[model samples]
Target: MPPFAYRRSAALLALAALLTACGGGSDDDDDVGPATPPGVRPVAGAEGRWDGRTSTGYDVLLTILDTGETWGLYHTGPIIHGAFHGTSGSSDGQLRGSAAMVDYDKGGQVHSSLYGGSYVPQRQLQAGFVFDVFNGSYVAAYERAVTTAALAGSYTGYAGGWPHPLTLTITPDGGLGLTPASTDCLVRGSIGPRPGGRAVYDMRASFTGPNCPLPHGASVAGIAVLDGPRLTITSVAPSLVDFFAFQGHR
Candidate 1:
């Protein structure tokens, strides 16, 4: 997709306020984490790392925590990247869920959607979702084992698109630091092995400085994936209205 077209979708997301009622837990559920919203449940056999592609041709990487919190990243073009977070529950081999998504390329416009599908534990997942005027399906295969040794390094790349250089450093102990060229924005975060030891890492970060996309002192939650020499991180603000993503190579 062209940059303008992506921005147009972001605008639509910002203007639409659609809600669907489904049988699930509420945001106020005592067990729900601060990062998880309503309509989420901890379903069996749905926690792991999934790699796939959407019907719209976007590459997708998704992580579902044991606690039912979900984080996902999708990209079709350099300027068409975004992230989503929610949870999925299963019943009789069917999966149902919802997520709040943010378009980082368009200044963090937010939207929500509902998804349903089927899955085979440790094998594959297929799901379809609708949000605003957009509808698409995705299929993913499960991946296993992600080690910190593979993630500790220095990476250089762009944030959102080229011409804006960004540097990321991950310490052996999972500490993270990010610096964007010629900018005061310095991001600090942490990454650690998830419960299942799958091809996914738990990630939490905070943005600081006047030049940052998110307000200073804002904390975001998400996940990270390492693909050979490349690293991808996708995170969203607590309000779910803003997101931070990075793609780089060691």
Candidate 2:
């Protein structure tokens, strides 16, 4: 259950069924309405291809300094080779948190991309995601995901009693971008490689933070593999899927 802190907590609660840039870490509810903020705590997911057998979900790249707060990078295909790397952030005293990169090949499939630094996507979902990367401060807890495959390029894992620094990047149109180490914070997305491998579209990301406050009905369902491969989009209101497997070579 330590797949790099559940791969940064289900990559932020099923990121819009696979990323739309923190698009409702748990579904921002139809333009923010219910107003459930105060001590929110939702983002808690971990499906690290449990090593049943099939998992070649490799190809990763993520980098974030101690400011970007959150970052991005993604990949899709039978990876699981060594399950990439692993880590998750949300200090008990550790610092900032999140993790990924696992494609051992058997049934390798898991792609994630993220980046938040616009100031905790509206107070970090009012604490639903909780925070404490030591002192950088935190208070949001919203995340998502479900599906993948690959063995492309890029990979990194360095969690040394941290404060920040999670990097990843995978392109080829599967565009997964996240850079922290100096900038401030940046997260990008675009991974739609379907057919036989999987991931038709996970996180086509389109974001806008800074003074974030536009939620209603609040919707952010989880589960996804994008579209074609295995566990297809499941929830997320009208669309937002799920389904994750590979350890057994599925």
Task: Go through the candidates in order and give the clash count of each.
Answer: 0, 112
Encode model 2's per-residue lDDT on 66-85: one tens digit a residue.
22223222224322222222
Cα error of candidate 2 at position 115, Å: 13
How would you encode candidate 1's per-residue C-alpha lDDT over 93-180 as one tens digit per residue? 4566778876655556677766666666545565554522222222121234456766888887655432476788998889888744
- lDDT of the candidates, in the order given: 0.61, 0.26
lDDT top scorer:
1
Error of 1 at 78 (Å): 4.2
Which regions in candidate 2 have their CA more than 4 angstroms from the true location? Answer: 1-73, 76-87, 90-101, 104-250
